[model samples]
Target: MNLSTLTDQIEQRYHTQAEYPWAKFPDYAVFRHQNNRKWFAILMVVEASKIGLLKEEKISVMNVKAKPDEIGSLRMMKGVYPAYHMNKEHWISLNLTEIEEGLLFELLDESFSLTIKKPPQQRLHKIPL
Candidate 1:
């Protein structure tokens, strides 16, 4: 899927907006959890060769969180690759146009769920006010 379409899907599914937080990197957009503000997905356009493709033409790509155990096998998929600028072990880059929508959204869902901030533990005892 393309950038607008991807962002639209995320907004519809999670009710979160795509944020552009970098001044120097205008083309990059980040999608984060609503409560914790932890990033779940990133959309970027980079030179194809930068991501190891043979050409230098700019292509749209997205980075999403992936399970450590599944990273290697996921990379073997047609459109998934090592993360462009994230921790390689916990993230992956997807060629936006090359991946199927179902698989793409699956990854997006996993990424969002994986970043949810667990609530803090309750206090067992309370002192007098």
Candidate 2:
């Protein structure tokens, strides 16, 4: 899937809009959780060499948070690479032009779910009696 199609799918499924925070890179868009403001996905055009591609061409890619255990295997798959700007251990960069639509959506969903904040734990305190 391309950037536009992926972003549209994300907006429709996650009810979140893409935010362009960088003035210099207007094309860089971040899709974040509305409640906690945690970023789940970031769409940007980056140098292919940055992601280990032999050619230094600009390519559209999406960085998504991946489960730590799955990162190793995902990186082994085609079109998946170590995250360009995010933490590599828990995130991955996917080539939008190379990945299949179904797998792309599945990864996107996983990233979104990973960013969700868990409820804070309640603590019980004992009062002096």
Top candidate, metric TM-score: 2
Clashes of each: 0, 0
Clashes of 2: 0
TM-score of 2: 0.91
| Model 1 agreement with the true structure over 14-118: per-residue lDDT tens digits | 889989999999879999988889999999999887668888699899999999999999999988989998899999999986888889889999998889998
- Model 1's lDDT to the true fold? 0.89
Please give, for residues 1-129, the per-residue lDDT of candidate 2 as tens digits.
567877788899999999999999999999999999999999999999888899868999999999999999999888899999889999999998788778888999999999999998899898999
State how far residue 118 of model 1 sits from its true place (Å). Answer: 1.5
Segments in model 2 whose C-alpha atoms lie over 4 Å from true places? 122-129
Badly placed stretches (over 4 Å) of model 1 are 121-129
Look at candidate 2 and tell me the lDDT of residue 22.
99
